[model samples]
Target: MAHAYVTFRIRLARHALADFIASFKSSGEIVVLVFGQVLIGLFALIAMPPMAASALPFYQSIPLLLAHGMAMSLPLFLLRRRVLPRDVVLAMHPLPIPPRIALAADALVAGILAGPLALAYIVSAAIWMSQGPEWLQADRALPATVFSFLVTCGCSSAILHLRARGPRPGPRLRRLTTLALGEPWRGPRIAYLWHRLFWLPFWRGDNVIGHQQSALLLGAIASAVAWTMAPAGIMGGVLDLTASASLILLADRGDKAVREQLGVLRPIMAAWPLQRRALEMCARAFSLAPVALLLALLFGAGLWQHTAGHVYLTLAMLAPVLLVAIPRFNPRARVGLVVASIVILTAVGSEIWN
Candidate 1:
């Protein structure tokens, strides 16, 4: 039973990554961009701490490296959360698998999902050790680093277990959602219904910070940076572009949800008196409001920053919007288009800066 469960989870994780990769396969540039983005992110994860610690004494670097490893637990937990759905655990509830076996399988799966990050730590530690640290000092630090990695794995496993078995919002939360949507439903019934069924859970559920809240926070931070630093260097240009891309991507979360629901409800919705285009426009207006607000914030920040990079930043930010707006273009294609725009814009901005 344990072996079977583990096999199931491994397949599940593989499928998730496969699907995400497949989403970018239409364009070679996008495929390259997706893989490159992931590789660079993981490389940064592996290299940054050791690079920072290289200048410090072995003793000092030990704490720094250990702290960085501990900090990585959050990503591990998020990886597990992404790959391992709660429904899987719920499905296993009726099985004859023992509690210990179930948890063991979960821990193993979490470790596998985060294997790249763990491998990064291992590589980082090896590089750190090569940098003229005394054998005794290295020996002492190695055990602690190993312990920290173990603890990080343990934390992710615990989070996975808890999240899978965790209590959901119950009857009261449902009642609150209905109330918020209105007793008789406000605005277009289709829009209100989507909000009640899908969006509200993320907004008012156990997770306080949903997609919209995250976007707002991101916008605030980017705006604050623009207002304060108004950074003009090549690095700043690249950062501004990255921030703009992130804002659009975050805003797309809700938009994607709406798109998915609309797809599912198309036949039923077509039966209504409203024209199909009108129905789509109404649902989209309800969904795309967050995207619009985020774009406004991003543009406002670019103007306020008033750096040489501002013009390029604004242009790059608009690329995704223009690409996604073309009739018959898949709205979901924005993810790849946004990343590609960032790369092209950053390269151009760098050359111009030079």
Candidate 2:
């Protein structure tokens, strides 16, 4: 039944949340971080009206862009958000009652979407699209959303089949990890690892996905600038593209990690008896630290005129959180939390200017 998918989703969400709490070893730190996330989310919610108000012109100016933007964003969930084992998929395949009903359920769950917020976002998009008006056609968002999900499902389905034929990459990734004792560590370590693993393809001159990441980053920057310069203009399309592209970048990175690292074989990395001086970490942090900073700066880039200090503080918050806390969590969980944190921070920043 559809309830099976729903049940699985709930279980996944629970596991992630618990892991999130566990990532912060100290009880006090966990409370503090959780409180910070809650406070930020609450502020974001409070500012939603104004944020929505400001974006109204853009949304109205290009409703189709909004539709497309929302639709394309769902695929980000397919990127390493969840990877269901092949055996599990085969077992659940029979539960769809009527095959057609199962088809819709599979499209909705798509197997790889493990993040709860991602699931919620995709479902919300579906509901909104179904009810949305389409001046160009009737109900543009509905069909667009469905198509988007179908594409995502295709990708997820491919991964399921591919996985059945192969092994996870976690072990390989660990082998590539350059650990050291007393290395010069600077910047956010999470950024360091993110840069190390996620950027490896780029660094090694892999063209396809690397270019996609760059193009998406450029699109997001352009969208932000266009919106700031002319919210009522045709920037909505760019924003839509930007929204999907940036999130997809995150998803793709997660996918790559899973593909390369074989995420399952090693549950916890065996730490050496001696605490490594982390010299290597410091030396290496530079590669991704700047990149992380750039992404953080983008969220509040437009707000610098009014809330420069706040914007900087927001960026400041991101560094340590990524460096320390995020790395402790599994790859999938790391990606999910980082994305959620950015979204929450962006929301909170939106209110600061208002």
Candidate 3:
């Protein structure tokens, strides 16, 4: 039984490996993952100097390391279906292999893929800490680093599991309700007034405000309030709130349009591929708006603060967006044209404007 179990596990591992490789069949997928990796590497490099200057004790670097590690993990988490071996696990479910063994194999495969990125984070943290003031307790840094890494791994796995379930309407509806409750008063008159006065402009022509937009707005306001009340880290807090709010607003508008088109007219267009194409177009447009706004906001902040690094950071952040946008080109020749345009714009803006 033990030998048979081992063999089954080996097969499962191979299946998982194959699924991971299949994800990169398209040039676009390869570009997106590679770009994401490069962005993570750049962020670590850029953040190192400032972190070093803070002169935080080695032990203190732990929280910062954890924060950065989690941040780096989030993009991958959001794109887990593209990066993970989901198909393999699902395929092997009816097999003779035990569930635990199959799960262990999946974890091992995921860890292997995520290992190098995780190591890059650790190395960045170590290098940044080495340049800082001497710590009274250097030994504690190692333990803290390990703990942070574990926390990140755990969180990453949980995110993958949740994402595998795919998008559902229940959570969306619940979030919308929560956002509606965020208005000044819970009374029916107040709620109606709030909807007609404040939310009407934000609502789509269909007479309904999107749940995602409302939730995002609520989150942004909450973040801004928290940032205002916080003693330190106000600048970072404000930037986060502003960026998130902008992204939410853009997403809300984009999603509302797409939903209106798909839900109301989908039955008529059920046989048409154009509906799918339209949705994809709206999605790309929606995704890009937040990024553009983020870059502009970052540039404005950089200009005001005279921080070249922030501007450069913002440019680097666009790599993933560009990668995703590349796949939207129907013709292969258009890819070259789009790529060239992006390069020219990035160079002119980052070098000349900044």
Candidate 4:
């Protein structure tokens, strides 16, 4: 039974890899993305952390590196949630595979897609952990797989549970979201209306701050951990990535409402007297309200302490936003511009912090 399970997992992973490759055959950018990511991971592994931290006691390095690895990999899995109708998609053009088994396989494949990211996290940390007190040995490989497998299983199980519910959410969900956010505006000045949009998509009865409370606590914990265990430059980059990710989640949660409103209210918006610059500012404000406040707090704290390179590090955090805001910045360009930019910027910021 155990052997069968192991084989099942490997086969599922293979299917995911094949599917990913086939899906991207018409667009070669996926190959560039994969390769660029590998290069970035390599750079991060070698470039982060101080030379002294690199030589710390084995026990000290292990805990910090382990925490760092978990911090990176676990949050990635959280973002993989999607509304795909796994059952219907697979069933439409039926593979000969049995329904019970195939759906399970699909769930596993969905999770396995994130395996490379999880693998990078641990391998990068392990390299760092090995830097201090001891050279890495070959005999400890089995234990590493067990640790990484736990994260994979957690991701797989969450996706499988979501699949078992139904084929995506229906109109009832749309109705509930409509009730939560309230009716869309007909027409209004951008500045006058922009602030309301933050908590506008929230649950109807709950206080505006209720949902943000958990995120606030998590950010606090993350900051405390980073201050203690991570270098300043790296912490800034991490916070930047975290901020970008947080905004992405915020957008994801309200995507349907945003799209629905855009569809219904386009004519109204087009008729508004707001200038192009004001509209663009409102767009940025709507997207970045939550993160902007946190960034302000961090900058304030950094200023009070006269933290060196704080300005540079703070600017580095804005780089990821370019991925979303800039339409022409293709990450998979022949020269790998975006990947190189991130690696170099992250490294230089860390060096300054160090």
The candidate maximizing TM-score is: 1
Q: What is the C-alpha local distance difference test score of each model?
A: 0.59, 0.43, 0.48, 0.46
Better of 1 and 2 by lDDT: 1
What is the overall TM-score of model 1 with all chains considered together? 0.70
Q: Scored by Cα lDDT, where does model 2 land?
A: 0.43
lDDT of 2 by residue, 1-354 (tens): 446655574465346445645643432332344346654454333312222322334456255444443444344333322334435545655564554444444444444343343354455554433554333233343354344444445655444344323334465445444432234658875555545544554433212445544655566556545544445323443343343234334433433433334242133333423222252243234334334544555555555555643653455445433634334456556445544554554444344334
Angstrom error of the Cα, residue 310, model 1: value is: 8.5
Compose the digit string of candidate 1's lDDT tens values, residues 233-295. Answer: 755664555555455454444455556656777877667775667656565555545556655
Clashes of 3: 0
Q: After superposition, how far is residue 238 of candidate 1 from its true place, in Å?
A: 3.7
**What's the lDDT for candidate 4?**
0.46
Model 2 clash count equals: 20
Model 4 per-residue lDDT tens digits across residues 1-354: 433433554464565457656644523443244345656766556323322233456677555545444444454343322223344334534445456664565555555665666565566556655664354433443344344445445555555445434455568557766654766555675643543433343432222232443464356446533543455564566654443333333332233233333455457667766574465445544544444554555555453243444644454345435433553433245125444443454444344435
**CA deviation > 4 Å runs, candidate 1:** 1-70, 80-82, 130-137, 170-172, 175-177, 180-182, 188-198, 201-228, 248-257, 285-288, 298-320, 330-340, 343-354
The predicted structure with the larger lDDT, 2 or 4, is 4
Error of 2 at 104 (Å): 16
Could you tell me the lDDT of residue 306 within candidate 1?
46
